[model samples]
Target: MPNIFTQNLGETPRQALNWRLGYAILCFGLMGASRGIDEGLISGTVQQKAFISKYRLNDPLLSESERANLLGNITAMVQIGSIGGALLAFLITDKIGRLWATRQLCLIWIAGIIIFITSNGRIGQVYAGRFIAGLGIGQTAVVAPTYLAEISPRAIRGLCICAFSGSVYLGIMLSYFSSWGSALHISSHSQNQWIVPTSLHLMFAGIILLLSIGVHESPRFLASKGKKEEATATMSKIRNLPEDHPYVQTEMLDIFEQVEREKEATMGLGWIGPLKELFMTPSNRYRIMLGLMSQLLAQWSGANSITIYAPTFFAMLGTTGQSEKLFATAIFGVVKLVASLVCALFLVDMLGRKRALTYGIILQFLSMLYVAIYLAIVPEITEHFQPMGNAKRAGTAAIVAIYISGVGWALGWNSIQYLINAEIFPLRVRALGSSMVMCFHFANQYGNSKAVPSMLLETAMKPQGTFFFFAAVTLLGLIWMWFFLPETAGKSLEAMDEMFNLPWYVIGRKGAALTASAGHAENYMRDDVEKVIQHEVSHDEQVTSSEK
Candidate 1:
């Protein structure tokens, strides 16, 4: 696999990249499918004629603004619920551990989907079900990445983490095709059109839960809880090595040392310790700020809005009918999925996080600028305006621009937003910090998802203005990332502290360079482990002589 992906395997042990580790990552990575399916499913589900008729979403009597508000409310409810879910995820992940957390969230997700499918014609039930589902779906953002980072080897950490990100597009693609297939074969009047596709939520959640049963809890999490022997055993099993193997010993020592340091730093602080460390410590405060800003910039960049409302956006771009719009959206999903896979398999580990982000954001900015300019120049397609000659060519270009934006998004913000938060913090506050980050993630997502419907209206930002806003945000994000986002590729979880120890202004720009020159913790730990092993061997021999 490493040969195929062309990942620089670095100095990582061959045993650490074994099948057990891969299976665990696969189980957790699929959690991203929960959010992906929801985002893709809802957009097409709402566009169904039966759904519109049953829910009266397109009622003739409702004003355009009112109808837009309703659509926004319906689409954004899960994100609203996700805010609360993310806020509480740290508590759940901390209390029960990652494996149990996966189980619980899956159950919650399944229950929510059941309620949603049985809603009949009740819009309130639809909202309630989706919001409930969001509770479970939201936790995936925090849990999967944290687990993946904690369990993975440093050399391929980016690849492992991006696996989760990539699965998001996999889910989106499957949901898009399911919706398109249902629209083609199922009767428009039948509720089965949307319900059948909605069942995908249940399928993915169930699969994740089942697969997780065989996976081990994160060894770092175990170490944090003072379960040293168990942590060593788990680490050995995951890495496919003996407990005394140099790789296993060095990695465990790193975890133990970090745990001890954190224990001292927050000894008397009790439950507030992690929170205090997160907010009061200068480095952690900076980390939290980065986490928040990543989400803020990513959500507002307009790529996510394009994803959630692909059909609507296609219609505005002059795709003529529902079938054509759905087909275009499905193709859009395909583009995103392929791009995300490329990021996961090649770009992330090979290019490094900062460079990957830089390149991706550049692509996003160019694409969004093209779309915004085209929309500004062309007559409004939603007003029954049809293009010909040069106008038609420009519209075609705009459609291509939208697809390029998805590619850029999958490569950049979509991967980093989850990866950065998961890897940046110390293990002590990893869950808490990730939870806080995802809380803001969902909050900003809710704002973007809800506002986009109205933002596309003539009375508000309009299609052109809204895209212009996205293009501007994308440009700002590119600048922010260049100056602030450090390269985190091939760095161990324990090595992150030294990476951020520089002055805030210089850290993002120069931190990676400093960390590289300073020597990695893994190298230091390996030297230390050899000395400890020799000392223990000598002591055992001395004891043997005394007994003889």
Candidate 2:
């Protein structure tokens, strides 16, 4: 049995989300998961499959090579469009609350589907649709994880954030299943056959649109915008507290306190101010680097590369069933989701920040190294590089092995990276930092979207080579973790600020880490930081009320 609350959840007692919110989370999680086809590869693969089949593509005349080129080009087009959408996320988030941002994303998804379908499988038009669909995925990629994290309470925050990642796998698995279902050999008469996946994708867009309306506005968003009252009310509903509950009061106060601090500090950055402040300070600069670097590790770790091209990767293994293999990927996604959920419970707050990061990095590093060796050592096993004979059997064994290794990493970084980032910054700067990190996450994710295809299309651009690159990056990530990242658990956002202010040499020295030394100054912004923190802390109000 799981205890929902641990560590008493702040002095002001954290608000609990009700069953309605629970249903909302489930619906949205499912909605977001459907976009995996949009993001990971369902739509891309289906479009190509339909294109190839309709043309009855075969050798040089029918040209599998031509189809490959077409697929690569169309996929790359979506990726290019995604970069623009991600950059736009920083701006959209402020205007549209996460819920509405996702709605906007669903609309983009719907547009992509309509365009793709209306083109009637025309190659040129499908590219247009992909670009449009990519826009939604890019936007959702930044917004959904963020919104889920913001609405969720601190206690189960990791689970909520990871659910977004789970959704990614969920979306992709469904895509694979959809694609496998559409295995009819290509013919010009059936050029629109790709519509199966695209149409299903349209369904995802519509359902998520409806689901988006159900969740409360993010408490963080409400707090950030100075909607203290509405923010408090939203917090109350989600946390299952009464309208005037002490928990609601504390959260309201914490939001105001953050507001109060921002007022005292010059809003030098302005609209572009947050962006400027983000890069201006060394403490934040390092965090941005660390966050991006960690995400780079996750992306380059071959985890995502494997996903975008699962059928192709499986073909390399001499494995007979692309459908089975895709399902296996789904299993990996589920396992990662479950593992993250478990880790969120015991290790999130307990393992300390540095420990969780290092552990995740270690697992990701090891998994990438293993995958590199397995693929390179047995490239000859299958036609597509899948295992053959007993070698095939062993390679099949290795696929699961490699996947589990990646899962080990998810237990650490997948959700924790977002959780860690949320805690790493002081409230004043958290959103900027988080969004920038989201930018990096999606940037590399797009890189993954492109790179995996390049590898699949050419043996010279081997998957093993990609894994090797990941292995090298893993080494860099470890050094960064050792040198720069600090333990952040059990400490409030105020203390986290102090931790970030120290020189590299002084960062991990327990005595020095906690106590500011002479000449090297540390400012906790003690008054403002505390005041801001307490505004959202309903439990803290109860304590004061009781003391009075």
Candidate 3:
């Protein structure tokens, strides 16, 4: 209707939400929703194990080792598919536009869902469905964050990028609650046991595919492909402004100049350009390496471990009944979902990245330590089957500790990793860079997901040892994050290179503090943008003089 973009350009980008930005968020959020739904379905497996067993996945005729292996494969199938899918996304994200790649992934997700709906408990069919769906999940992981990052204005980019993670946690909570609800009414042996949970994934995937049809292609992608006019038009449309709008013009010029500089820097490198730019450049490599490390540690933050095995974790908290386990797991999911939403919307941009991470990790370590200590003290009452006197109190404390741990995880590692992945890299290699990081993420998640079950049953350390192990890992993660993680809130994507190129000592401060000390970082960014545009202007003038 009326031009909201014109009025908003005068306001801070963070405070303004034009129709285009709203549209972008809506599209990206839907993609995030599907991811959340898929995660909920997969993690629902913890509750659906009996359904899986009824399907003969854990057939008694098979040897114990055979059953364990099959069960392990089924659990890890999505992660395995995700790993492969990330590799594929890495190779093709730049070739096809982000929108196109996402469209393709939606199709894969739909196909996977159809396979699951019709599998009829055939193990091969079940694995095939998960694996196929995983391919879509893997690609979505890279593309969605990258898309949101590219489209968002720097002032609100952290919050916008965080929508992806927030929606994911929302989906996880939805799955937990929905599965718990279904568990109350349906028999474990009923055909609906698996069908109801798996159907949610199909419904979400279909919604994502339908919504994606209206999404505009990323302006950065268009510019990178040498379509300047189209890139400018897309940027204007996305910003809800005319092409001549000063804000739109400035934004377009900045992107073009940065893209040009990248091209000049990597001239003659040919097909290996993006890869070389990512790893061979010292600053870029460090940023990506840190991103990879963050992702790896994020998986180990014990959040995914809890989500995938919340029912088991509840059992250890002195809740043995199936209904009790489901109810507890659902509550844990609710805590995480609430914490994640609050942190994503308020804390991420408010506390700045480093402080949020530090505080979150600190609390996380304490929560895990509480678990380890409680379990170590009461080793006799294994699996919450018998809680006598102090044991009952200890179990109650452990359950509370689990809820606190979910809150800690939601506030910090869960949302921060994706934001870092989106913000750290440049346009040329952003897709490849993000894909590489996510590959490590999915791999570690797969390992942790598989390891949790084995840690509880097979390890000599038992469940007590597993809690101790995670607590120890959480401590290490805390140290690693404090030293290596930089505060990146409010910095533009184009300015990342200059920002990272600064000394490590300076990079450690809060983004606002850094900006204050740097004589207004926005001015610095504007100056840099002007210099690039000026260079092009002077070169044209010189050519004209020479010809005359």
Candidate 4:
């Protein structure tokens, strides 16, 4: 049977999708679980009776504002560390290479988790540990997608890159189950209640570190460093093709040509060349705007806040009791996981990036709108007031709407936020560009996560207002994307320049069409590869005869 993934392979060699490449993508993709596990586990962990009692979070003397601030600080600390981590990642990845960077970050993640679980009664230690871990966890956002995009075949690039996004929900789902199980199986008075679920951080980090040992460095990074022979060998191994194979040769040529072009564009600029190119060039500046805005819009859409505080949101929506709220949150994680898988397997490649985003955003908007209206009509529901008849039914639908919003998030912003930054920039500054974008990604996320507790307060936005705010942001994002986001599916990394070359005003709407019309050469045909091979063979023969 033909592989469903290969439907878009066009004329590309089948060997490009080998087990070695799969293993590598899998290894890097697991990096996403680091962030997911934290988001899922922390909400339930903090709510654990033992944790709250030990930390004095439930002290009767504590005001609502103080409690909100404390919760925000605890949950948002990792994002703060991630901002620094994202900034540090470019330097680390560029200097030590992608594989080593992964290993180092994994170590940082494990160390932070160790400190966190052993915090005992000290809240400061909890903060310090998560902050330290954020340094490593944050870098994964920059590193994993960058590595996946660089190595993947153009046909399956979306599928490969979405592996990272998909694993996020996988981590969330597993962590949710872990948290739920601990809550049920362990006594609430025992420290092990939260400690056992937190151990998952160590397990994921250690597994990724071990797996990194077997994966090779990115060929694009090797080519950029002027190690052409090593790059070719690495590419050959990843593609499961011989060094002399025309497919491998063509790929190497694309990488080399892009490197040479970037060199010419940044000549005499020294070590700061990539920075200068990123900021000074019109096209790059526009690309940066797109990357920044994508993160901004995605983060404020309130989907992530919901993920981080799933139990809180469920409680607010009328799900009572610790066990009941946690069960609802676990199901929320499952919904997100399934949605992410659907996006990875079918939507991203089949529907194209723009359309997938459009559909996802619409789902998000409708869900948010329904929830907002429900909250507006039944503001007393959150105060433990029971509703009768139709109002109760509407309350249940609001819960369903929250779940639908999770689906929308997985389909839309969650997938695009990571995938777009990875593919949008030139190879010369791919790491730098992705790092900078993710710094903002985490920064905005920190703001959203840190503010949501307060935002949900009666003095602030309140429940109806918060959901309304999210709905408004979702609508704005849909409009911004319609005007600015171009179709990137099936396009080669090197060919992105052509797509971005279209005028800024029309680029989002017409760039892909224009580029396709002009026929940007990706050189996927067998005949094209054969010609390149014959030319190289003839040149080699001439050199041999001349030496004689």
Q: lDDT of all predictions, in order shown?
A: 0.88, 0.61, 0.76, 0.90
lDDT tens digits, residue span 232-280, model 2: 7777778788867544554454455555566556366567666665788
Cα lDDT tens digits for candidate 4, 66-167: 999998999999999999999989888888899989999999999999999899989999999999999999999999999999999887899899999999
**lDDT per residue (tens digit) for residues 147-190 in model 3:** 99888876677778878887787777787777877777877777
Q: What TM-score does candidate 1 get on C-alpha atoms?
A: 0.95
Model 1 / residue 545 / CA error / Å: 22
C-alpha RMSD for every candidate: 3.2, 6.0, 3.8, 2.5
Which has the higher TM-score value, candidate number 1 or candidate number 3? 1
For all predicted structures, in order, the TM-scores are 0.95, 0.80, 0.90, 0.96
Tell me the lDDT of candidate 2: 0.61
How far out, in Å, is residue 21 in model 3? 1.4
lDDT of 3 at 190: 78
Once superposed on the true structure, which residue ranges of model 1 sit more than 4 Å away at CA?
A: 382-384, 517-521, 524-548
Error of model 2, residue 374, in angstroms = 3.3
Query: How close to the true structure is residue 329 of candidate 1, measured as C-alpha lDDT?
Result: 90
Model 4 steric clash pairs:
none
Writing each residue's lDDT as its tens digit, candidate 1 over 20-49 gives: 998998999999988899999888998888
The 10 consecutive residues of candidate 1 with the worst lDDT sum are: 517-526
**Residue 523 of model 1, lDDT score:** 71
